[model samples]
Target: MNKSNFLIVALVVILGAVLSSVFIVDEREKVLVLRFGAVKSVKDEPGLAFKLPWPDTVVRYDDRILSLDVEPLEVTPLDDRRLVVDAFARYRISDVEQFREATGAGGEQAIAVASRRLDSILRSQTREVLGSVSSNDILSSDRAALMLRIRNGAIQNARAVGLEVIDVRLKRTDLPTDNLGATFERMRAEREREATDERARGNEAAQRVRAQADRTVVELTSEARREAEVVRGEADAERNAIFAESYGRDVEFFEFYRSLNAYRSALQAGNSSMVLSPDSDFFNYLKSSGGISAQ
Candidate 1:
């Protein structure tokens, strides 16, 4: 509780404060110790560490996984359609010195640079490949393959910054409003014209079919009439032949029979009567109604 006790407590506090500057590396992190703004020790592992107080500093880096989303790049499709594509990139720092130099300003600055690099690569690849693709192919599929190439390109560019890009993925790809309108209009017009042509062709074909059907109907009707006339004439010819043959069998009897048939057909109805010779078959028919008594 005296002056010596006060000095002792003050020294202990200063020593504790200086000891507080010691570096504590975690198992999940890597650290680089700098003294007087110069490289001291690059601790790649975890556990306890030491550093000069105030004049010495420690910079810890997570060698763990980190994700960065690059800004969207507007690219032209092979068919000249503009597409806005967004991509995400994943990376990790593998080398401490390389990372330190690469991330001069910080990981954030390094990420920004890498993002730019990715954007450039994506834009280049899209412009080169997608610009020459057909509209059908572009509409049907992703022609650019921006993510894969961009990831590979970013890793190559990021090597100087000590970055290990794990993967690159295209998050979104969409047509720009202007390009969308134009493309849609073109497609719609194409489809509409096709529909119109199809309708016209169908109508023409229908007309042809109707004309052919009508022709068939007329031909069938004419053929039926001709067949009916032929059949009637054949039947009439047969009847005449039978009559002729019967007459040829008995000439006089046929004459008498004909005379009687004529009288019956020509006779007036009611009280009207016919005046014929007594020898005629008319009188014979009038006398004998039982067909000459069959004797």
Candidate 2:
């Protein structure tokens, strides 16, 4: 070969070797340099990285916090109420070297393996923590504390997989669909019972008020009638006293006045007619100024 051709071939081989030995670590990723299936170094900082060429390799993993949505799981609380729980977690790769070792895989497969194992850990912790509390606690505002407990538990187990569990949260906690209808029915029945009790109490109060009002009305009417009778009797007694005084003052005049009242009452009828002799005793007042008999 010519010297010029050989020099050009050597320069090309050198350039390829340089390119093959170099890699980049992005700010969003962590890199592992492996030689013959063994980790040589880890590059987490964003910049140029180097590795031995041929049979040496580079593996990259995401450095950002990752989110995982857990599949809905059924749990029985301390109250023995079964609930369908949907949860999610936030995590990150804390140590890439440990992660690669624990996962026993390289490239993207490591992330998948770690995720499966972490999911199992998280689910177990979730069931354990949630089962220790009642359904009311799970459904109440205290759920934040429960979630913290779950995250803490998962954090402990996650270290084995080189993952840092940042947070765990319950997206939804609800009665199982099979039991939801029964629970609603029970609640409705309870509400109805309360309403019935209230209605009964109200009715009892209304009856009491009505009975009291009726009794008051009867008492008032009876008192008013008694007063009227007493007043009528007093008026009758006063009239009789005046008539007795008139009789004592003039006996003949009182007799004449009485006769005149009798005559008026007997003649008060419409179309009245009477049959009497001219000398009847009833005509004594007409015959004389006094009520004495006219001889």
Candidate 3:
């Protein structure tokens, strides 16, 4: 052989030896080695490894967290409403053998297959299982529990297909396109109705309170009027009695006292200017009636 040909052969042998002896796995990955179309061994750790290159195939997969996003699906709610749900899942490969055997003996292809299965699982679960439960329960208390149950259920199904589901979670569940606007309108109407009812009740209570206060005021005013009437009647009766007693004591003096009192009260009440003859009847009381007076 020529020198150049000899060098080429040596290079080919060296390259083959290097290829046959070398295997590498990342820290976040695991691998399965297949020799002659049969799985020879599984590598769960990281770093360099040695294997026969010609007949052995190294299958690498992520050992760390893996995530899968599910496309949105249309769902019919218990209330007969349509909703679109989109979700995701985080998982890790639990068994290397099952993963290799079921998912085409490798991580990349195996995850793809597992994703399809997980999708089916999610769809079926949301429809048949989650649908039967109350919407309030799902929205309120059991959301986490529901997710966990779905995760466990997915894990169980994944195991059959050589996949291990670490977790499953819901990202969003929303009203479908046509129903979104209607749902918002209905929710707004319901809240507005509630607000209106609350306001009406508050107004009713305020009216009742005002009416009660008005009634109390009226009652107190009537009571005060009644008391005032009683006092006035008693005062009038006492004044009349006093006049009667004075009149009974001396008839002429009583008449003189009454006439003088009337004159004093009438004259002092307003501006008065009076001109009268002393001998007139208006001044008769002060006149001397020693002989006889006219009737």
Candidate 4:
């Protein structure tokens, strides 16, 4: 080969070697330099990185936060209530060397393996933490506290796989279909008991009011009857006194007046027939023109 051609080929080989040795690390990724299947160095910052060509290799891990949705799982709480729970988790790669070692793969393959491990950890922790509490706690605002416990537990287990758990959350919680009917029946029975107690109390109050009203009516009616009897006695006494005064003034005229009154009373009935002697004193006023008795 000519010297010029040999020089050109040498430059080309050098340029290819330089290009192959250079790599990029972005803000979202963490990189590891492995020497013959052994981790040699880690690069986390965003910049250019370099390594030997051929024998040295680079592996990447996503440093950004990642999400995983857990499938619905059945859990039995302290109260023995069976609940179906759906949950999710947020995480990130915190240790690249450990991650690569644990997964035995890099990049997308490592991510897939890590995700499965994370999901399993979350499921185990969820079951453990939630099972220690009652269903009421699971359904209440205190659920935030429970989720924290779950996250902490998952973080401890996930360190082996180089994962840092950010947070764990329960997306949905519900009674299992097998327990729903019984739960609803119990709730219905409780409400019915409350309603029955309320009705009984209302009926009792009504009876009390009615009794008081009846007592008030009886007292008022008795007082009214007593007053009427007293008024009637006073009126009778006054009328008798007037009659006595009239008799003292003129005996004959008083007797004639009384006779006229008796005749009016006896004859006032419509279509009434009297069977009495013609000399009856009751007829004295009718027989005499001057209203005097004809005895």
Candidate 5:
């Protein structure tokens, strides 16, 4: 090779070596320098880092918050009710050396292993903390407190695996499929009983109102009948007194007036016929100008 060509190849080789030895650690990552498969140093802060070009490597781990969703599992609470629970966890790698030692793998593989470990820890802790509480408590507004306890427990247990459990949350808590039907039936029966009670109360109120109205009607009718009878009795007494006074004033005139009224009543009848002598008292008014001929 020519002199200039040889210098150009050597420069390229030197550039490759320099580039291979240099690595970058960003704000989102924690880098580990492993020499011969053993972690030699850890770079937690964001900056430029270096490692030997040959037989040395750099492994980057995401230092930011990570999320892992646990599959739905069944748990029995203190109330002895079976519930289906789904949980998720937020975590971050806290100790890089410990993390590397635990997984013995780098990059995505290590993250996957750590995630599996974290999921297991969270599931166990979830069961432990949730099982101590009643199902209603787990589903109540106080669930936030229960979640905090589970997170704390998970953090404690995960420390051995180099994970920092930031938070643990229950995504959903539901009754098991086998129990849902029975629960719905119980709810329906309870509602039906309440409805029945309301209807019975309404019917009772209606009956009371009807009975009171009937009683009021009977009382008003009875009172009206009594007043009518009193008025009728007073009218009869007044009529009898007037008749006696008229008789005392003129006995002959009263008899004549009564005889005229009787004759008029007998003659006014439709197609009426009477058999009587011409000189009979019944015809006195018709036979003479003055009834009874003033006898």
Candidate 6:
């Protein structure tokens, strides 16, 4: 080859080698430098990273948390009730060296392999943990506690694949389609029975209140009437005593006052008139300005 051509070829080869030797590690990624398919160095921090060119290759795996959706699994709880559960897990690549060895794959392929392995672990653990509990526990407010147990179990198993399991959660747990109608009917019946009981209790309370109010009204009215009768009796006794005292003081004057009151009552302004003889005793006071003897 000519000197000029040889120089150009050397420059091209040098440029290629420099470009291949250096790579950037993003903040969200972890890198592995492999020599002949064996791990040589790990770059976990962001910035420039170097490796020998040609035979050496760089493989990157995401360092950020990742989510894996598990396939729906059917579990029979301790109550022997079957449920279809959908779950997911959060994980991150914690140990890249071990991950490489466990997955036996590089780059994005490692993530796929790791996911499959971790999925198996999560499924097995999920079934084992959930199977020991009752369906009520799985479906109630105790779900947070059950999820924690699931996460703990998954952690131990996921470590084998160099993944740190952050959490395991049940997205949904549902009765089988065949059981839905029956379950809903039972729930409706239970709610209606409870409502009936509440209404019965309310009616009983209202009756008690009404009866108490009625008794109170009767007692108050009777008490008020008794007090009024007592006052009237006292007034009658006082009036009779007063009449006796006035009769003892002056007999004629008492008779004259009583006759005057009689005249006022019998001659009140109304469509009422009395027919009497002119010599009647009632006219004695009118005949003479004095009394009956004077007439």
Best by lDDT: 4
The reply for model 5, stretches above 4 Å from the true place, is 183-295
Lowest lDDT 10-residue stretch of candidate 1: 102-111
lDDT winner between 2 and 6, please give it: 6
- Count of residue pairs whose backbone atoms collide, per candidate: 2, 0, 1, 0, 0, 0
TM-score of 4: 0.64
Please, what are the lDDT tens digits per residue for candidate 4 over residues 82-174?
A: 889999999998988888878887889878888899999999999999999988899886688999999999999999889999999999999
lDDT of 6 by residue, 1-295 (tens): 9999999999999999998999999999999999999999999989998999879999899899999999988898997778899999999989988888888776778778878988888889889989999888998865998889889988987887789999889999999899888877866887899999999999999999999999999999999999999999999999999999999999998988888898988988893499988788887788898677675
Off by over 4 Å in 1: 1-14, 107-146, 188-295
| Model 3 C-alpha lDDT per residue in residues 1-295, reported as the tens digit of each score | 9999999999999998897779888888888888887889888777889788677888887787778887888766565656676778886777777766666646567667767876787677666646766555555544888788778777777777666677777777777777778978877987899999999999999999999999999999999999999999999999999989989997877776776776676577454567877666555555655312433
Ranking by lDDT: 4, 6, 2, 5, 3, 1
In the range 1-295, model 5's lDDT, one tens digit per residue, is 9999999999999999999988889999999888888888888888888888998988888888999999898888886778899999889999988877777767888789988898788888888998998888987866889999999888888998788999888899998898999867866887899999999999999999999999999999999999999999999999989989999998878888788688678787574687878778776667777556554
For candidate 1, lDDT tens digit of each residue in 101-197?
6545343454465456545544565455446655455455573454565566666766766767788766777777767778789779889999999
The residue pairs found clashing in candidate 3 are 100-105
Candidate 4, superposed: residue stretches over 4 Å from native: 186-295
Q: Give the worst 10-residue stretch by lDDT in candidate 5.
A: 286-295
RMSD of each: 8.4, 7.8, 8.2, 7.1, 9.0, 8.5
What are the lDDT scores of the predictions, listed in order? 0.70, 0.88, 0.76, 0.90, 0.87, 0.89
Q: Return the TM-score for each candidate structure.
A: 0.52, 0.63, 0.56, 0.64, 0.61, 0.61
List model 2 lDDT by residue over 148-193, tens digit each.
9999999999998789999998999988888998878866887899
Poorly placed runs, candidate 3 (over 4 Å): 1-22, 33-41, 50-58, 75-81, 98-105, 121-174, 184-192, 230-295
